[model samples]
Target: MISASSQQKKQLQKYTMLEGERKQGQFPLLEMSHLLYGGKDQFDKFLERQNFFDTNPMFKVNHDFYNKSRQDQILLNAERTVEAMKKLSLGDPNYYTPNVLCPQGIFISTVHFAMVIPAFQVLASDDQITKWMTSLKNFSAIGCYAQTELGHGSDVQNLQTVAVFDKQTTEFVIHTPNIEATKFWPGELGLYCEFALVFAQLQVDGKGYGVHPFWIRIRDKETHKPLSGIEIGDIGPKMGYAVKDNGFMSFDHFRAPLDSLLNRYIKVSRDGKVERQGNPKVGYGSMMYMRNILCDQYTKFGGRALTIAVRYSLYRKQFKDDNKQEIRILDYQLQQQKLFPLLAEFYACVFGSIKIKELVNDNFNRISQSNDFSLLGLTHAVLSGAKANYTYFVSNCAEWCRLSCGGHGFAHYSGLPIIFFEMSPNITLEGENTILNLQLARYLLKQLQHIVSKPSAVPEFFKFLSLETVKVDDVTTIDNLIKLLGLNCAILTKYAAQKLMTHSDMKESWDTKSGIALAKAASTFIPYFNMLCFLDTINNKAKETKEILTILARIYGITMLLNNMQGLLLKNQLNSQQIKTLQDTRESLYPIIRTNALCLVEAQGLSDNSLQSLIAPKEGDVYMNMYNFASKENSLNKQQVHNGINYIQKMREVNAKL
Candidate 1:
């Protein structure tokens, strides 16, 4: 009888529960993983790299990473950086980027590989790349991107750091003219980086040539100290990126060699003559390249948080059921209500980002291969909005996922809090989201103006500007929802554009009254694009998994439509009945989706180590691990009674019996 009860207990264990969920999955797991990771080869690489870290004792994480002090974390980060560079097989160009084997969030040298080197690849000449790219990519030298200033974060045109061409010495004198001009907030710049791709105003013969990227050695190789005439140190204490040293710098008229000027677009001669090969506007593109790439990465970043939350929800139980047995929290409709749409939305974001990444790569190729920058404006506009909206979506939902896990999410052991804090910075990074929203609006207005004058010349992407029909009937259909959103975009864009046109000075108009409207307009455009991406992926890529994907798509499409339909409702573009239908359609999906929750989240392919959570072990034994980690590994647990010096003897005297 005891053995039977034991077996029954084993059957009810979360391990068995989660395993059962996995078995109930509608589609094959490997097939889904292959699709999510892009393809078979890519997924294989992910496994290979993931396995390397998984098996390697050196990469094993111990202790609560959250409890680590800044200094300790920084030291550990640096050590890991070196170890990863030594053990990993990287440097295969696009096939094996350096950060591929790295952690999800920012590391000590992330900016070097992700931002600094990529900047040099596009902005640096071929010879410059040949000289420095290998060493940087190989982790021999650390670098950072320095662009934002103390006074100016978004206004690139009005930056105060200047690099004046000194023809006599064949050097550029880089200087910070005022305190406000101090270069600030470059990751890894404080304690680690030896070099920086600094953005400063280019002045040759006392004639300004706009701001440009200059490769400069900021720190000594041997001493690892800031070089002469360079002031560099960490900006102490931030909400996140504790391991990363976001730094500040000021140049005391530091003289850099003539070769420091990244001359891919414009060349500077020894005699101080400037040869401009590309338009001045191309400088803006150089800065935006990293921001554009960041758009696609948020979804992947968000998957880490979702994985932990979803897995934990599956294991966590609450009040007993009618059968006098505890039901898993996931059984509650409220829990499903909170998490199912996010799961669907996560997949939707991934599909959309995949398509956006392709466009970004294509636009980059056009600029490099053919010197064709015709699509530059459109690319900038699309990415500005995407980066802004996608970051917000990921950050917002990540927090939502955290809250859905109830009180356990508050524990750093859950890995939820850290992910939320780290992700919070992305909304303001690259370009501040608010500024980017207006930047996107500015780009759309340009396109809108073109379409207004010449109907035939309206670009297909901007053809949404011509969409006037709004459908309230049959709006529950995915295609109809998409069309209605396009119509909404048209209305918002044209309305904001009209507001700007009322004044001769567009900037003044945008700054005063229409900025909020334009921001709304830009935010509206992103989901429209995402839905488009979703439809494309469904049609072309996901035919085999279409059954599950169809449900997911409808859920995502409906939530997005509902989110944006308030304005439409106020304007009578959408009726209450249609809105209710869309919401009802979304609700109907929760049950089917809750059944497949494990399949959907696991498809993202987040590993246990990558998650780094006590509450979310892949084995589904969450509580035991949480207890062991907190009671055993936590620093306070080193002593039976932490810091109770006077009470130690008294406490021991009282604990006579067990």
Candidate 2:
């Protein structure tokens, strides 16, 4: 048998070989990075930030970092987050990337940066901005967006938290009437945030005016103590994101000045007369912004996980080939089957995210200027569908990457487990994926009704619904493939609508019975959008890059079809022969993609510091790097015997006495 020293030496050799393989690719890594980052300047800026983090010990991922107690982790995260903000001058407009504030993963300051601050910017009136925005920017009063209550997560209409307007004091009395009304799972509210953008049902003169956002102080800004009549504390350790102080809050009888109401789209006078302005849907802007952010965040999660998995697969050697030489596990057909398609999906998500973000920004600007709510419905539907789809895809991809790595993936140093845990909440947060998808289905059904009534009046996005049927022969071409997917989407939507219509005019009962069908219908639109964005990107690319992206796009399309083949088969959209053809096409593309897999992942331009995976070392010193890092950073390594040993000894003595 080979000794431990021999095994170590062999692993080093494999690492070196894998490093050599990565360098043998034909495409230029820098050029791909430029493409991925949007431009050379953006790539440079990303590199600069990455280099800074690389040298900062505070950002390092030590083994003990993952093993820390929840309280310690939260405290450390809060300190590091503040220090990062200061050192990086994070509030500067030039340095603002959604990620600059929460560099590694979810941080204590995420809800403040992504939700609270953005909500204030978009929904707060000019006067309110002037009074509170500066303090928020300066971190004088940290804030959380407290929207989800224990009983009402996605169903905002039923939120029990009440805000009654007191015409006498010109104040809003916010009260949590019961346990279910307590605000739950607002990041930073548990420990750090001084204030919150609380969503409560507004009661004016004993009449309900739906849920509205009101700014309320939850804790004292000076002492970081819970304010009088406010009860707040951390909700204990979660599956992941232990550092984030996701907390619960309840107000006994909190009073806020009338000006605390975000009155950009709605206003109320001191006399208690409520005046609604702009579109009522505009109140969803903050939630929409977070959903948009989630689309991009999913790309990041998938990219990082793929980077680690792909790199490790290239280094791990298992069975010997016919030549009696052990080949890298990456050469196995099964491994490629698991990872390559995901790599393509990751790219699709990247492009799709950029498209959705641009769409949202344009719509937001239009709303601010003209209050043209024409595109608001479409934007909401698209974002809701995309967010739900992408989060589910990325979360599943992360788990698959972990499983693909075999035993090492189980170790915390592998980085996959943390990613899996951290991102798991994404499916439930913002909006539950199932509920969000149903919302999209509802939108699609509306559009379908319009199409049926007047095909010419259908919006540009749904115009394809009136097109000619896709022939089986056309499935080989990308455009035809897209048409086929679109056809599937239309069919699914129609089927879901039919199912809903069967409920005998009871809308609530229809929604309840058609939930599964509606979710499935909405999910079909995601790949269609992804493919549309991906095709647009490839069409705009130069010839060389276009060729590579075409291959990736094909892989993505085929993989999506295979994954959803059962639905397509049931709908008669694809036949057995076509399914076989898709399988064959997927098989044919694997080897070609395997040649460029390393280069493709490298193009994402993720830094070693950002990845924080020992298995994905920059220099490809995979085994030794993991060994040394684990040895140095694991707190248990420093101890000769752990406390568990004494417990075992005591149990043995009791058994002997018995």
Candidate 3:
């Protein structure tokens, strides 16, 4: 372990911690990631591939082929990106973001892997899967998730693009008959993908049957040219994700073989009978699945920022004593206030993400085996809302971390600008947060209606919203605090659910009025969920570990209760004295936690390499090396320059002249 003896050495060690530690299992702060996600085989091979892909061939392929002639580049990059993907062994889940960003065109296709593929797996007929799945996986062809159109994105039922049946050839003729019908915001359609899973109005024998995904090849695989009757190109730049080339496309009369339709859940027979295997919403399963993975994605972004900020804060020095000795920025309470909450948040997010991943996997398994979709459907709404909320919150936190570093934070070298830029698009992608939150509201409303009809069907968690009772445990241990917080989270959801049910017709109006509050209510689950994870870990461990975890539990609950004061007040959940007790407990826990901050961050399992800060050291080096670097760099001399009368008098003279 690096020495923490000198302030200067400690500062220099901060940034170096994230550099290569992810590969070493030294940074993620979690002790049980191996058990939760998989073994070292899962993580190590991924790191190896990340290194390979970040190097020459992939870089050249992305830069020369994808960035140069974006129109033509799109087609080429699609092939190249697929080729790279084919090289992966698929033995492990490879989740590394390349050190360099892929062009938006490519990021779009990559995201499609997360956003759309699961739906195809679940929704496509066996034959349909057999014909395309292998090639799709092997990258013989590239595809896009084309659901959102210029005319209507969130409202799936009202899409303008139509896929009409041509009974004569047993084919589907896809057409964007109007300007609005043109597919918009598809990632690779402008240039890369040869095929797309077009979400079009499935018109069978002149009757519209809402939106359905049809796999249609848009380009010739051999010649790399757009197929007959297809128009696609870039949609131009936006606030972020410039590297991802979001593109627009339209079809004049594109034709596909009859079996091209993804007919897993809902299908049209050769005779034009619309046979339903399941609810159409099941088609949304893949999207919801991506939203779940995005929970981890958000945590990653937040964790990376925290890693940088923590190290940078340690390295950066400000005001000095009369002896002119510089002090680490982290020594200040103001800096602590700005960053420690986020530091705590980083830990919270990792645990929360693991929990969400477990939930996702459980739901996927249950849905895969039993095909009983009630839980899947509920999770779809709830998970998406949770993902949207947590990701947005983390993004904001990361940017604030950047800002807290002042000028150095804006520098790309500090890792904040790219981090900030990279995180912004998460708010709109997969599904816009506003629209997704409404989906949650809708789901909650449905649950409320179910409870009204059959009270026994409601989960115990929703009992608070039942209007009939208020029954929580009389005990108030830390465990109970966690439990009550869980109950509080469920109650908040139920409250919103009941209102949504009571004013079902006013969903849009209520969404407009109470949307932010509803989002807040949805997000309340994160801290509550986080507290449970920590407590669960504690309860499973030795006594001393439990004691340490108890402090975090108190901190987590008290912090949350303070934030949601309105809920506590409106629901009469806690008395005034209890609220004060929570606050007092929180204050008492702060110093106890402060001493353990570095140890806590270490337990998160994030690598020093990924942190990209010099001050936060790895296993080998910490404060001594940083102090040496700082002393040798002569930062104290620079401080003397600032204090020198010559420099000060020059500055004063200039100011007086001005």
Residue lDDT tens for model 2, 1-658: 9999998897777556656767766566777777676678977887777766667778765656766776677677777766567666554423444343233345556678778988888788889899988888877878999999999888989999999999999999999999999999988888788889999999999999989899888777678788888899888878887777888999988888998889987788999999888666776787887788788655577888998999989878898999999888999999998899899998888888878988898888888888787778888998999898888888899999999999999988888888788778889998898888988988898889888797766778876555435666846567867887788777778778888888886577556788788888888888888899989888856666787888888888877777764455656778878888888887898887898888888887777777878887656667777778767767777786787899899999999999
CA lDDT, every prediction? 0.78, 0.81, 0.64
Model 3 ranges off by over 4 Å: 1-87, 90-92, 96-109, 269-271, 279-281, 321-324, 445-455, 460-477, 483-520, 542-545, 575-581, 604-609, 612-658
Minimum summed lDDT over a 10-residue window in model 2 is located at 93-102
lDDT of 1 at 126: 81
Q: Go through the candidates in order and give the clash count of each.
A: 0, 0, 52
What lDDT tens digits, residue by residue, belong to model 3 across residues 398-463?
799888888767644455665666667778877888777766656655666777798877654344
Ranking by lDDT: 2, 1, 3
State the weakest 10-residue window (summed lDDT) of model 1: 92-101
Model 3 compared with the native: what TM-score? Answer: 0.78
Instruction: Give candidate 1 regions above 4 Å deviation.
Output: 1-12, 89-105, 280-289, 540-544, 644-658
TM match of model 2 to true structure: 0.94
For model 2, the superposed segments whose C-alpha errors exceed 4 Å read: 1-15, 89-105, 566-571
lDDT of 1 by residue, 439-493 (tens): 8887777667877787776656778877656655688677887888888877888
